[model samples]
Target: MAPSYLSIALIVLGEAFASQLPLFETSSLSQTHLTAKELISSKSLQDRIHVDNLLERANTLYSIAQLGEDEYNHPTRVIGSKGHLGTIDYIYSTIAQLGDYYTLSNQSFPAVVGNVFESRLVLGSEVPQSAIAMSLTPPTKKKQPVFGPLALVSNFGCDASDYLDLTSKIALISRGDCPFGTKSSLAGRAGAIAAVIYNNEKGALGGTLGTPSPDHIATFSISDSDAALYIKKLKDGEEVQASAYIDAIVESIETTNIIAQTKEGDPENCVMLGGHSDSVTEGPGINDDGSGSLTLLEVATQLVNYRVNNCVRFAWWAGEEEGLLGSDYYVSVLSPEENLKIRLFMDYDMLASPNFAYQVYNATNSLNPVGSEELRDLYTEFYTSKGLNFTYIPFDGRSDYDAFIKHGIPGGGIATGAEGVKTEKERQVFGGVAGDWYDPCYHQLCDDVGNVNLTAWELNTKLVAHSVATYARSFDGYPKRTGIEATAVLDVPLSKYHGPKLQV
Candidate 1:
């Protein structure tokens, strides 16, 4: 005999009750005068949001690293790390305290996190220059320092023919035209013992192989000056002997995305906003994303004091540094009906670059979804009303919103800036050093709580709160949700989305 629906429901309810999971109950609203309609009126909720609250939360996130010795050395909230897991616990517990007002779930997913233990490049016994190991490059099993005669490859080394007769030599390639992975694979196939790729333009080279490849030998990148000197030495009939070493670990780890949605609103129409929860292995990443994550958390926490018309979902995504894995996984697993319920998606990332610019995602482009333009306009209007000048950055699917956009969901967000150098024109408009990077400590050990620009951080957080409040009040100006299968029409390479190439 099959079980009845009522009996199944009773069993599920019993399990939930036994587990002490808080379930949504509309009766709870009677205890407070802050009803959904009242909460949205006259920008009341926005006024309640304070920058102090956001900073306090950010400090709390930073303190998570101070809890124990393991995190003290790393001091990073990278996914699967102790600091990151601690961050997850904080968010989960914080949201769980809201009880019936919000429904919270931890979405689990698997991700492979890579960390470069040691990377070095020794050219002809000169002072060894620092070189970043390309992500996913296999460790050399032969010896600690693989020695070889340096040979230059032609045309970016994308083809096998470009690496002919390179047996037992270190193939030196330039950055351009193809991925670092392609060049590395071609070097390995041509019987080269190791590979060194230098930057074509100015500055240090930092990139990834996109994925792990067996054909990828140990590869590293140096500066353009270093490569130029080596090429010139080789052309002058000087043998350039190079030694390269890289030790790295790539491990599959399990992580969770903390998701919370308002229980008081219409679930059929939902507004989603999120930022990456994890940081790079270098530091605590307080500004890289701690600014954005805590902004969402602060906004979500304050929103619990009120109500909403349409559901607002807040997510703290993991594995974002590993190429948007968490957000991508979240969207990939959603059913068609679930996808359609999402009216719009907003991403908040890197909102506190030390040298900042108020940048909104460029949704006016042809590559955006049907309703993205309106979303962009809403942000523009919000900034304009405040007498702020903002610029439109390309929506190149680099951040967490990439997945949402690929699912046909209209997506937009704001960024202060990252490693991109601030130009003189931007300096005239935003009042910052012209040649300085937006965030000098991006993905570095210095990206701690002190790396934030409080002015930008506070302003960006308020903008987040405003957006949330506006959309939660009503989706009247936004287009109806479309269930059409999404394709990345503007699929620009990830390299184009960020500033200059920095460390991986």
Candidate 2:
């Protein structure tokens, strides 16, 4: 027989009490304060926010690894070996602090095969120099490589035909039509032992391994400037090889993923909220998502107090900086039933920084629904309701949500911005100065806490919470934002969701 509503309520209640109750140093509630007319006459709602103590605790918790000062994107100095591990560790700690309101787990995957490196290339000659190798890459076995120096040969903007004869040779090229994995596969197919990629442009490279290849080979990247120096030397016909090694054997070290939850009730109805906690070895990533990570923790902490229906989850993913490795692994492992149970995926990635504008990807191909006009309207409505202003954009269904979208989940999310400086047109839209970075710190060391615009940061977090709660409250059977109409929603066409195309 189906479990009775009372039975489910009892179980959820037990779980809620299972953890230490939220201390609610401040009453954990929504932005609406009833004292409105009386208080609004003088005070600001922002003033009522309990920032100091929360910031202290959050900083105390988030400060692990003294990450603010760390060079790696997501180091787990206090938890696991890599930055992703640190993310899982934090989720676990938060779960414990929140009294097991949720349980955190990890999903491990191997992408870049063959020899791995321990110390992430902090900045190979330049901040954007090191191309992110797939996790499947094995660790370099020796201090020095059998091959003395590697060559910097252009793949001709990722066209493999350029370097046809590279057997036993390592080639450095740039990104183009081919996926990184595809290029690597082609290089492998060409008998080339390995390949490295260099950027043609100045910004950070955001694409992941384009296609998945199982070749056990050494593959990575060096910046365009760094590659140029090598290229010049090679043009002069000088040997340009370098040794490579990493102790990446599974036995060498362990990896983990931490998760938390609002309350999993009935086990059938559940909602999820998550982000990759693990950072790259590139930069500190306070903005790449340290801000989002902090936001997730704060929202989870705030939501834990209010009683609700359905299971709501908070997951801090690892290895996201490593091409969404952790979250991908997590999604790949879910039972078909579990995957279906996740009605929505509200992903919070790099939202706090004023550097970038905001975008929401509504993926329909995967488990999630496609980007709909209604979803956009919901965001605008939520923002306006909270007295914040925002422009609704389309969905670019990338990121870990791909895992869910693939499983048929209705995925929608918020991102403050990435690279691509805000244009005058966008300035007219979002009201920021033109020529400013959409997310200047993107993958750089400058992605510190200071980069976050406090107002925007706080608003972004609140907006996410509002969206999640609205969905949960209205989730009688279907995933819908409360009081929102289908017609009112803005649908970012699939083409635009991935951003614009170049004009000839």
Candidate 3:
């Protein structure tokens, strides 16, 4: 059972402690006399989350994706695709059927969707090697293939000198030191027709150029082994001829963000939780965010059985894969009065990576909002109480929480893992392979229903439920809302921070 306190003491002590702790505060004590609902405990809500039921729902979503697979030529729920539209309809219809318990609405916005039809590299008549085109790169308009002599760029291709006179040629560059966009821009400035960036490590390179750039020529990624072979041949005084072909589509499309808010709770102090509803072009993204999306749906359904003091809003964000587009748009459109009503925002993305670790966002370090530390501590306490080990992920804006924190809303959340390789120490603690990706099939076609770690998914969902239930009852230890005008963080471009480019 959770601890309890007297109403006056809770509020008075909260104010007294607010000076010492930036993330601590409480609502007015006068409002304590408001009629309280017959609420269920967090443990009761956690116990109500059945793993079998969760899996069954997840499988149904996968089936929906299967039905919509023909449109995209792959099983994906990417925004503006049939699969994602179906996903939105399903979520909206399901919550709408819950009677008058919640108020639901679909917030529509325009998003630039990028589709790579086919990308290839042919090296001197050898079999065409598989390559992934950088997202948002303009498709080649020329009918003839771009054929030119390949020249190696010096020092990761980030400097002007690295790209000398190389008219009508292709640049072969190593990936490091800067964003893939910066390197491609340099290649364009050097008069190169295209650019191919090879991985610095021992694997196939797959990444985004961050955003659309007119200066960015056609760019593709290749395996480190292939790059090494090309370098060796060049070192041996052999001229290597390369041909690059890319078929892609980049266009603006309309998408929706599903927002549902409880009707019975205090509307002024709302608790918001979200996860991206869209997937990559490769696969169904069942585990990538289908896990988080469904977990929220399941919890929201069960929460209808109880009541709360503060409103609970569930947001299924779209356009996260194209650089946090949907969530950013949602925050950008909020008026100052509307923004103040949101007390805090919690995000959940990739909650069930196969090589899982219980990771809470480390709000104590970077990008800490007023009440972020308290949110982090709450999650930490929840896992510790369950006799489970946990770790902290840096609070870099890599998920839906990015825009919320940037807008001064206290934020925190959990992730099982993404494409990051697990260390030996992490393996010992989490009981998974040391040198393998957290989600081996991340952003790939195999990230279907079977890719999730059921144990991790179930446990993380329970923690989410716990957080929701605790905050719904009262904002005893949360920061008081201040109607300060929020400055747009999007005005300044997001830096070239690299990691697993899963969601955001």
Candidate 4:
């Protein structure tokens, strides 16, 4: 059982949590509410099943804690791709440490554009000394100031009409309703040499958000602090031009998805639990996903020894911070046949955002809900019994699950919340303060060690173990869960890939 407060929460769960508990669990089957205390002392399910040991292995948050920004953001996968090497090494030093039934797989896919627009910025004066990664093409020359070469987009918040009015200069704009990528790509299509996006928000643009620049266009996000001075000068009738250049050069660097298989007796279908291991160049994402990455690795270690009824594959995706590249590619590379073989998908993106609220992303009808409707329904029952108040967070299909769903695979997962926070309505439902940031550090440098909500992370970790263990133990026929909306046309294709129809 959880602490006293949690018990009260169960009671306060009132209608939804109370009535749904029994339906979520059965006597022949175990409930998903196994606490850390119970998990530590719980005996093996069968001679081959040991959930407690799995929890212990899944609790290696400290070792991942020791990983510096460099290691967390870098590639141990120097051979085939960049990212976690353990995923591909059928034999891993990490798995050897577990000394159990864990199989490392190359988990390799026909590499997609893992890295696009690797750039550097050094604004001499007009733009202060800062780092900016615009979705535009990289500059051929090193470190160009934001003047002379850049063109300013006047009256931004309005239509991009001003963009069409301008000639072949790098369009300078401010961030607003539209994404930087969208704006850059727009300018690029209009013959703009590149894009210089001055910050409209208060401080720095922080970290890379998404990859919108399809290809060939150069884009850069200038600091708002620095853009202020330029804007002030320009507004005051002082002409300010930036010397910016973008290199739209193409490169073929290998990127891989880490895959580790947990074998059981019968393996007609498989379940996937993963977190992207790649981090931004700006900082090591110990928390942006390090929290989740470490958590996923721990879960895999603990269960590597479990003997179960279904196949469970643990993955550590790369380039997620870089727009779900690793997960997207792995799924993109899979043949239609391979995709159909998947039973379900789970993502552990930000398991612990320091001072964050507990949240779960619900797969929707349009997203194919990541997995079969049956899985979503099962998860709903699982969370209900656990007394967890879950919000039906829309699936962005921006995680590894995106690829799986693209191929019609079933998917779902838990999240600790990100930049999106709870509104007054949300707070009312989940009990967190309204107006509080979901994760203040979100993707910034501050998302490092010592910045985590241990309780939230611990609970989520346990949730993963419970959900995964229960999933493995139950061998329901893959009759295809149903009842969510159909996949949306609004959903973008999984990858920016176009290869020989990838084989399963």
lDDT of 1: 0.77
List ranges where model 4 is wrong by over 4 Å.
1-91, 108-132, 135-137, 149-168, 173-194, 198-218, 222-252, 366-373, 422-436, 475-504
* lDDT score of residue 353 within candidate 3: 92
Q: Could you give candidate 2's per-residue lDDT for residues 1-504 as a string of tens digits?
A: 112312322232223222412232323222343112131100132233343423443343334434323433342222233333334444454545555345444344453212233523322233333545544453333423424345555545355556567766766666555555566666666665556666667644434343244553455665566566766777788776554433443222334455665443434556677776654444556666677777777766655544545667777766555445557677778767666666677778877667556565543332235333344456766666656545444454445554555455566677877766777877876777799777776665555556566656766766766766665454653544321111212243222121111100
lDDT of 3 by residue, 100-185 (tens): 66777778888888887777777766633646677776665462468988888887888999888978888889888788888888
For model 3 the local lDDT of residue 68 reads 47
Which of the two candidates, 3 or 4, achieves a greater lDDT against the reference? 3
Q: How many residue pairs clash (N, CA or C atoms closer than 3 angstroms) in each of the candidate models, in the order given?
A: 0, 56, 0, 30
* Residue 41, candidate 3: C-alpha displacement in angstroms: 3.0
Q: Report residue 198 deviation for candidate 2 (angstroms).
A: 6.0
Q: Is 1 or 2 the stronger prediction by TM-score?
A: 1
Q: Tell me the tens digit of each residue's lDDT in model 1 across 272-333.
A: 99988888887888987899888888788778777788899999998888778889899999
Better of 1 and 3 by TM-score: 1
- Decoy 1 TM-score against native: 0.87
**TM-score against native, each model:** 0.87, 0.66, 0.84, 0.66
Cα lDDT computed for each candidate against the true fold: 0.77, 0.52, 0.78, 0.52
For model 3 the TM-score comes to: 0.84
Residue 475 miss distance in model 3 (angstroms): 1.1
Per-residue accuracy of model 4 over 294-349 as CA lDDT, tens digit each = 67666665564446666777887765644566777777676655665566787777
